[model samples]
Target: MNEITLPPVSEIDWSTWVPEQVATLMFILRNDEVLLIRKKRGLGAGKINGPGGRIEGDETPEECAIRETNEELLINPINTRFGGELFFHAEDMPRIHVHIYVATDFEGTPSETDEAIPIWFKLDQLPFDEMWDDDRIWLGHVLQGGTVEGYFTFIEERLIDQQVIFN
Candidate 1:
């Protein structure tokens, strides 16, 4: 009889498994146009979405939003207000804990960033067809100035399912 051999189990790297804290700003133009980014890479690459990024050390969510806006869009969001918050999880990617904000006023004109390109479109004309599948589920409502919460499941960057509750 031949003996069977199996590979030994390796311990997981907790650091690499830690969930990331992300922040974003939803800049609403006077014409109900919302600021979106065409990501240069990753799951939503080439897709239209919001302007924001990860929360750096010692920075609050609001601060992160402000910083990200300047860094990613070259604009200083004014009178920015908290709109909503979302917590997304999937087995394939790092957990995303995001805070959403709405800015009706800003200091500088919007511009592109290394990671994203800033673009504007009428709210009613949002290109859902070019955005992440999950955006169509919760983003529209959020832009209407409502608070919402949801859990999204994705399989290899494709949204498989989501459960959302609006307030």
Candidate 2:
């Protein structure tokens, strides 16, 4: 098998880089359990992730977060608050900037949709192996009430480099 080669992270000028698309990721935390989803379609199809999607016309990141969660899980996030931001740079695909939110409560019950399948996991037992590589690096911080800013570089679906700052 031919080995996959990736460009050095330094080659990408992050200082002036801008994301082509803006999105959101919302997680509902109740006690020790966090709600996640098995995405059935879209960019990260087949990966386990928070419920979120691209920002629709004129909607703010927070609004998009709430809207997407309701659409994908049939629930409305309550007491939602901004948690962090993530910047992704992937080879050949548009760069993306994601706003992260955490909710302490939610209205309605989580149900499966064409877009995703809702799943809840204990805080200490997140299935990182089935999630985006960058998730494992910064998700713990968010769960612990810490805010973060993460920059990730990917070559197709492979994570090649990352940096995260907790504040």
Top of the candidates by TM-score? 2
lDDT of 2 by residue, 118-145 (tens): 9999999999999998999999899888
What is the lDDT of every predicted structure here?
Answer: 0.73, 0.92
The best candidate in terms of lDDT: 2
**Candidate 1 local accuracy as lDDT?**
0.73
User: How well does candidate 1 match the true structure in TM-score terms?
Assistant: 0.82
Clash-forming residue pairs, model 1: none
User: What local lDDT does model 1 show for residue 35?
Assistant: 82
Taking every candidate in turn, the Cα RMSD to the unseen true structure, in Å, is: 7.4, 2.0
Model 1, position 4: C-alpha lDDT score: 30
